[model samples]
Target: MDGDFWHGNPKCYRVPKSNVEYWTKKIEGNRARDKKHTKTLKRLGWHVIRIWESALRDEEAVATKIRAAMMRHINGETT
Candidate 1:
């Protein structure tokens, strides 16, 4: 996910006081949708590797993870 707020990051997201219910529902829906999509993709034989927004803060770690996933896929190890 690109955004901490929309993706429901516990350490970063806080519902706005002005419209608590609306924000809560919106963020929750986003999380549900993300989960559903990831599950669907995996079921369809996709290697779904989710890199959180916070992980992007460390460029080297993100690159390493991507490389590892690619290597795994190349080795026919989807799991």
Candidate 2:
């Protein structure tokens, strides 16, 4: 599960008033590293599912997303 804040959730992400630059860089670095890791995982033939921390609050939505991913996998779609 990815932390919404760290991964820069478009819905609820905000840079802190204090240490704004630091937080921005940190989150950006995290996003970059996450992208890299996701690429590596997919290259190694892993089905990647990124469910945000906040998204987990809505169980039905999460389930639907997972089910969609599963269907895509069963249909031999990889990304």
TM-scores, in order shown?
0.85, 0.92
Candidate 2 off by > 4 Å: none
Query: Which lDDT value does model 1 have at 56?
Result: 87
Cand. 2 Cα-lDDT: 0.93
1-79 in candidate 2: lDDT tens per residue? 9998989987899999999999999999999999999999999999999989999899999999999999999999875
**Candidate 1 TM-score, true structure as reference:** 0.85
Q: How many pairs of residues collide in each model?
A: 0, 0
Q: After superposition, how far is residue 58 of candidate 2 from its true place, in Å?
A: 1.1
| Local error of candidate 1 at residue 57 (angstroms) | 1.5
Question: Which pairs in model 2 have colliding backbones?
Answer: none
